[model samples]
Target: MGGGPDKEHVLITLFDPEPKDITGELRRRFPHFEVTYVQVSPSRKDAEKAGNEISDDLWKSATILITLFTLPAKPELVPK
Candidate 1:
């Protein structure tokens, strides 16, 4: 979506897939703006690598990064 000079676009990256309730909350909180969810394949060995590549592409495309955080995994940190 295009933004005016006074407005700005924001992108938030969450390591974990957001729960349905949380997504609904976001929709309720920001009704005027657009919201989209991108589901990356966690089952693939290169999922993280692919995500990093895509993030880099987005950054190159002039998308602003507001925040980035990874979710905690189990003690073993097993891949899906």
Candidate 2:
């Protein structure tokens, strides 16, 4: 699980261009790592839609979590 790209899972939970853009760049730079975007909001809009896109399985497998303001209400929801 602590291995390199093959075991690494990158979870992008940032706003706007960051989540969308960084996911693409990371996928290009490290094809072996599982890179995904969650399109997290700043609590202004679309948080629910983005939250639905992320599953508990995805959260559990995430080795690297890049996020801004979006976070789960309970830490248990996104255990590392």
The runs of at least 3 residues in candidate 1 whose Cα sits more than 4 Å from the true structure, single-residue gaps closed, are 5-10, 39-48, 51-66, 69-80
Clash counts for all predictions: 0, 0
Clashing pairs in 2: none
Kindly list the per-residue Cα lDDT of model 2 for residues 1-80, writing each as its tens digit.
54353778877787766545656787889888887676666674666556665787877777778776555555676655
Q: Which residue window of length 10 is worst by lDDT in model 1?
A: 71-80
Cα shift from native, residue 68, model 1 (Å): 2.2
After the best TM-score superposition of candidate 1, give how far the Cα of residue 36 lies from its true spot, in angstroms.
Answer: 2.5
Candidate 1 displacement at residue 33 in angstroms: 1.3
Per-residue lDDT for 1-80 in model 1, tens only?
33444333334444457566876786678665334444444545544553554444343332233334322122122121
> What overall lDDT, based on C-alpha atoms, would model 2 receive against the true structure?
0.69
* Alpha-carbon RMSD of each model: 10.1, 3.5
